[model samples]
Target: MEIDQPYGTPERDVMCVMVCGKLVDIDLHGRRYDGLVGLIRAGGTDMSEAMVAASAAWEYARYDSDQTMPGFRAAACQQGRGL
Candidate 1:
């Protein structure tokens, strides 16, 4: 999902959150993508926890949350690489 950036493309920086030596989450906030980047950047100890928080937003939030979004519940998160 990489794309040309306004300021020019930068090398992708792949960051991950490891839980017990396993990658539980990943962050590509500075990369050339959308959606999950904002969630990750919202701030957390790691991407995995951030992702969980973001996903849970749908349930815990009153409105304008991922849960309220039409398709967020079924949205596919990339939980790969032993996460």
Candidate 2:
């Protein structure tokens, strides 16, 4: 798994999570948090759940000293990419 920090503005930060050459999640944080929350409230929990989990996992892995997101790495490896 890889956490990609693409170009973003002060109002929005784009975080992309890729596993086995496939994009599994994309998280937009910072000023867009409220909008995302509102979307979740108006939509449903299913999408929110996945995004939240991905965001949390990204945070944990990004901050950890080892800099490794084990879950995503394992999944990516199993899917045939060494990442």
Candidate 3:
């Protein structure tokens, strides 16, 4: 599973899920923070689970990259601070 931004447009966020090296699902949210709404609109029944999975996948991908953006990392880290 991976998050992909459209080529030449970093604003569009899309999540791609692969199973056995084959593409299974693709979730697209107009903005990164709109993931839950997007998933719901796409027929997801478990919003909380979807959000958690997306967040974990994003964090894992971000930390695995050497050229990660500090702002993105900070924003993601701050999301559940009060919870």
Candidate 4:
């Protein structure tokens, strides 16, 4: 995981986590869901490892991690060009 301080939006310069090349929004303390609806873009690397880490928040997390809130799994991740 890497912090992208310049993850820009019309509102402001949102910070996001570069997880296996996928962009997951994060907060000052850690994982964030401030304005997130879902992943607005896709990734090149296998994003499962990064997905698990990104969805670590207790309320939104589960055994499958990706099944709970982030809402896209391994197969879906690679489908077409976006998720």
Highest-scoring model, TM-score: 2
Which candidate number would show the highest lDDT if scored against the true structure? 3
Colliding pairs, model 1? 58-67
> lDDT of all predictions, in order shown?
0.33, 0.33, 0.35, 0.34
Tens-digit lDDT string for candidate 3 (14-66) = 22231233433435445555443233222432332333333433333442343
* Residue-level lDDT for 54 in candidate 1: 39
lDDT tens readout by residue for model 2, 11-77: 1221223223342343443353233412222122233333333442232343334334465545554
lDDT of 1 by residue, 18-73 (tens): 23345333444453324443333323354433334334322224423444343433
Q: Is candidate 1 or candidate 3 better by TM-score?
A: 3
Model 3 alpha-carbon drift over 4 Å, by segment: 2-63, 81-83
Candidate 2 error regions (>4 Å):
1-60, 64-69, 81-83
RMSD of each: 13.7, 10.3, 12.4, 12.0
The candidate, 2 or 3, that scores higher on lDDT is 3
Task: Give per-residue lDDT, candidate 4, residue 51.
Answer: 44
Return model 3's CA RMSD, one decimal.
12.4
